[model samples]
Target chain A: MATLNLSAVTKSFGATTVLHGIDLNVADGEMIVIVGASGCGKSTLLRIVAGLETPTTGHVAIGGREVTRLEPADRDIAMVFQNYALYPHMTVAQNMAYGLKIRGTPKEEIARRVDETAGLLGIGPLLGRKPRELSGGQRQRVAMGRAIIREPKLFLFDEPLSNLDAKLRVQMRGEIRRLQQRLGVTSLYVTHDQVEAMTLGDRLVVMHRGRAAQVASPMEVWARPADTYVAGFIGSPAMNLLAGTLAEDGAAVQLRAGPLLRFTDGPRAGGEGRPLTIGIRPEHMLRDGDAIVTVALDLVEPLGSETVLHGTLASGEVLTARLPGMVPAVGSNMPLAIPAEALHVFDAETGRRLDA
Target chain B: MQDAVLARQAMARQRRGRWLAHAALALGVLIFAFPIWITLVGSTHDAATIGRGDVPLLPGGHGLENFSTALGEGGGRMHTTPAAGMLLNSAIMALLIAGGKIAISLLSAYAVVFFRFPLRMAAFWTIFITLMLPVEVRIIPTYQVIVNLDLFNSFTGLTLPLIASATATLLFRQFFLTIPDEYVEAAQLDGAGPLRFFRDILLPLSVTNIAAMGVILFIYGWNQYLWPLLIINDRSMETIVVGLAKMIGSGDTQNEWNTIMATAVLAMTPPVLVVVLLQRWFIKGLTETEK
Candidate 1:
């Protein structure tokens, strides 16, 4: 219902900086997901926004009200933790009612909201049962219901679906997305799973170490990752990054493995013989194209409809190609084509994108 | 014929082993129960019968008379009030001790585990060190403090010093540490400040431990003799345990053995009842296993 702004929010635990001056502006009713590997400080940034953690510097504002120093309850935000964190002794209804009850809502209002939320979550039958009696998925729903009943200005989810089994996790992920859309509440969800990030967020913040590496829509981040780190992080079979150099005319990159890959996206700000790291996604490695790259086969994975091939380049780096169905078992020298537009180039040393 | 004979011999040996095990178990049970059985029989008899050194093995005709007298007139010691007063005093003391210790310990433990305050560990260790110095170790100084405060012969003197031990606090601290950090965060988001969290979440979750600790502290408070003996001199304020011991009266030769035995039986009943009554909750282990 309201915009959230984090202006240079930094957090440090003792001497170790966990989140380094993170700045994000989430539009009203937008669900922005922060995704990263473990220790990347995505969770810390989320916590700082939640008011469970205090940022070492900068400000957090929700609905135009500065809440950097406010308590989570005072910040008007609800968070669903990874463990659900339902009060174990309380029944599902009581768990949902706790926040409103604490806020001194009228008895009937609290009861009505709790009942309505339970029904929305399809957990009405579980109202009287304590959290201990509920299944894992059921507990997760109750945890969500606990947050939704508050009807807070914003919702924060810290990998809420991580605890469920893979199948359940997918189901819950879709449900969470659906609920958030239906409610149209501003939400920030943090997770390490790229698929969840891609599917759930209006925009994805791909974090690396203590900083946001790339913040863009899912498809934008996929098609044009801001850096080599994000490119490697987003795809299923990660983008194959090879050490290459700009061609003498600056129109293409010459691979150390002796393949001349042309650039079709745009001309980059790099000179001839400029050392660069060139990336090509697995799915975009085409079998029919004008540009050809010869590779030595290392391994192959047959995943039903499509077969993914892993090959060793001449420079002794791994290259992957995802091609559709029944690839004839090619010998040592496997000839493959990579379309030019799918190529991503970054400065070799800094790892920053050169195709800006 | 030889095979059949061997099988029969083996069966006989197994029977003998079973008989021996049962006999040993019965002997162990008897050894533990003998004193209680004798006390029960002794409590039922007249003073003349027990005083002649012929303790009866069965209930005597004086059972009702002995109980009624004990209940109505106490042990007949000088200025001795009825067993009812002493029983009430004991009940008050025990409940207060258990309840006071639990309340204090729970609060202190919550503070130590959840909050980050200056000198927190110092306070915890200070409390923890009290475990080394039980009331029995520092009785005289404690007694002096009670006397200086004009708390003598009062319930305050009897229960206050006993409540200062750190076992309950340390026990609760350990239990509090096992609670997940997420719950604390969840409560904070739920707008429950420390006190509310303590009342609603921590206390309810600790029901079994509190019950278990209650059983222990009640017995500890009930069986107290030395501390109460030194503090309360008023016959009206006497606990049943201490009063039962007082009936022997500093080498009084005319002590009524039947009344004393009846009072001993009375002293044993409340603590046994408390344990029996709270036993269900006492045995339910900590952690709801719901997660």
Candidate 2:
């Protein structure tokens, strides 16, 4: 097990910066999932840790040893690529045994370790089969088994589940989580899928434009996003954001679309009449709750267990609410209520969360 | 009833098309095969019959006599080096040229594609420029160098100059570029240093390209005419192609036409056999390596 630390890691391609200075300390055996849209530099950060790419300026320390200049093999780490880059020519067993063989491990030891890892990955019957002969999931397992057989201090995964089908993705996600825990190896996984981030990461690093938007536990990031980007990115159907101004007493918001929603959680620090951005989750919109707003229903999406209602406000701004069942018919300007205490308050100019 | 009539009409049209296609195909095959057929038939006649300018269409009674004379007793009336020995020499030259070109080109292409050093592009372009100068163009200079090095009549002189192949190197370099960057990173993480990676992964994956290139280079080396003729003045050091060409020297009246035709057949057989035997791998290598 290893405790990994990155100190102000910054990377740039010529003049365009890809990863702004990022500082993070991953606890021993903790799985940190870096979640972001494409070009957000999550994959670059993982590559930097893998020694595939060097940060323009920063330090990477693994288990108290600086490996910023070491080669990938010398860094005591293993990485699974997005495409599952198993050698197409080698059989599954040879693919897994390659690292040990390169290190001059004894033949019997290499065979034993490969057999054990193949059994662990449930690919024992595939030892003689080439990668092209195996199914996609089987190839992914061989890739993982190839990494696991190395037994390195760190495990790096780059969107490993993206090639699998949805059900297979969920299955492999649980398998990865359990395997990480059982081996207790510090791991860093990067994916653009937010659900994978929430379910797999002990802690999530939500990145925006080149910076880590929020680095916290999944629940904390879900509950208290640091900025507007994190606020909308980490939730399903996204958290609804409305433009408004604070009432003179600072206890309620005067929405641009004409509604006064009180802040039952108490007044936040902001000048009276100052413009603000109000945040609330789609699932938090209730049928008849403490605070209410009028929405002209446009469409209803019944997702089996829940229904998502899409509507527009009087100001022509779109709004969505997730409720337990179907709501009223389309084109109706009906009032959807929400708990006053559930509102997230952010400043209009900076997009930073204003309420603690 | 109308649809049935239409279907019958279409079937008749298809039958007509098939007849035309078969006739065209047979004509095409005949155009290509007639020369080889003449060569085969001419190799079976007596020297006097062929010398009279009447090309034979069928095998004559002297077929075994002509082949045995060309193979064991040498095609030329007074020459001591048999066609069989010359054919063996050609085999050695072709195999060595093909094998050496592949090994050297693979190593050079690997170095140029995988490693970074000074003048890499310059080196690549220099190798590429060699394509413009075939051995015939630089015969005098190459011959002088070979004479100076005392390799004038050896297999080294026959194959070494011809083995510096730009097409094979460029083909290999292009193929190497198609290897995904991820495999290199994976090999690096697997602790496979450069040479080990080249041997264990890159080499095996390149088997198709190697086989394809081998077929091309073998035919090229086997068919070399002027370079082998210039360097190997000794009849014992002659290749089948060069020796056969010498057997028909100056005019048809003085040459042993039947034995010369038999030697030409011997010269062409090995290369055609090589292509036919490796055709499957050659096509697959050309088409499917990236997959």
The candidate that wins on TM-score is 2
Q: Largest lDDT belongs to which candidate? A: 2
Residue pairs in candidate 2 whose N, alpha carbon or C atoms collide under 3 angstroms: none
lDDT of each: 0.90, 0.90
Q: Alpha-carbon error at A164 in model 1, in Å?
A: 0.6
lDDT per residue, candidate 2, B1-291, as tens digits?
999999999999999999999999999999999999888888888888988889888888887888899999887555456899999999999999999999999999999999889999999999999999989899899999999999989998888999886888999999999999899999999989999999998999999999999999999999888899899998888999888877766743467778878887888899999999999999988998844
lDDT of 2: 0.90
DockQ of each: 0.71, 0.76
Model 2 residue B84 CA deviation (Å) reads 1.7
Q: Could you tell me the lDDT of residue A354 within candidate 1?
A: 85
In order, the interface RMSDs are 1.3, 1.1
- Write candidate 1's Cα lDDT for A225-338 as tens digits: 999999999999999998989984778888887778777765667678889998889998988787777778867788989999988876888889999996756456788887
